[model samples]
Target: MTKVTDVVLNLIKIKGQKKEEAANTNERPPAKKQSPGELRLHKDIAELNLPKNTKVTFPNGKDDLMNIEVTLRPDEGYYVGGIFVFSFHVPHAYPHEPSKVRFITHPNIDLEGNVCLNILREDWKPVLNINTIIYGLNLLFIQPNHEDPLNHDAAVVLRDDPQKFQRDVQAAMLGGYVGQVYFPRCK
Candidate 1:
């Protein structure tokens, strides 16, 4: 009876070991988890319907969805034929928090790339998506808001003298010096 019990126990152990090995061989490595913000951004980007003059690109490739670059080429505005690129860094608290946008060649944008768009700052809401921000940026080129500006001097000029403002914008777009700052040719 002792010999028979020992044989049965050894059989059980061998079966268990075989099952464990099979399970290990069939299992795959765990997939990396995506944060809620990444999930939301993925949805937003997948559903993007960009405007005719606006295009969005990922400098870090599609694998990294947090950083984005938006290029605008307005066809009928002060910035017509000019190319402007804005970088957007979406935070982990996106939607709840606004994206950080940086672009350096507009009346409402400073030389240091500080933007003064209402939706980007005080008026931002969770309901707004990337498309909303793109439209807002496009509108800025179409109709620059001198009332709220990051470049006060440019705003003042736009407000006080429309023609001079247009000339200055043209000059800047053509890679000329505006005041002490030189602008690169974006056209």
Candidate 2:
């Protein structure tokens, strides 16, 4: 009986070791989570040079630094007196990947808030930071770039008839319908 008990214990130990090895082989140790971007972001935030009419807020609370809201109130140009809201989502990749940005839905902004601007798309470079983004958003209102516009109709109107484009912008900002599309008042 003693010999049988010893053999049983040895078999149990072998089975346990095999199970441990299987789990270890199947499960990889998680990669070390290093966030160099978070530190850089803190520095960028400290040195933020936003225009006078632009303001940034974190709706998810100050503790949640990953997401931010930028409100641009361009004092000049066609979009003057209108308030534009944009959201910035900083990804884990940081400076390596550009922060994702979206604006409140408007003629310029699709339903997904994907506002088309050079910096957010083709013009984006790792060197650009939050400050540059603010400037870009400001430029969107100060001067609507028709050549590479996201809103094709708006761009055509702006290119062909500047006055009519201004009227459409005004109407849209005043919560009216422009060509059957209803825009909420953002002025």
Q: Pick the candidate with the highest TM-score.
A: 1
State how far residue 72 of model 2 sits from its true place (Å): 0.7
How far out, in Å, is residue 34 in model 1? 1.1
lDDT of 2 at 184: 88
lDDT of 1 by residue, 1-187 (tens): 9999999999999999998888789896545798888888999999898999999999999888899999999988788999999999998888888899999978899989988889999899988988899999999999999998999999999999999999999999999898889999998
| lDDT computed for candidate 1 | 0.91
Error of model 1, residue 136, in angstroms: 0.3
TM-score of each: 0.85, 0.77
Which pairs in model 2 have colliding backbones? none
lDDT of 2 by residue, 33-135 (tens): 5477766677778899989999999999976677889998889988899988888998877777778888643345665678786777777777878899889
| Off by more than 4 A, model 1 | 1-29
- Candidate 2 TM-score, true structure as reference: 0.77
Give RMSD to native, each candidate. Answer: 6.2, 9.8
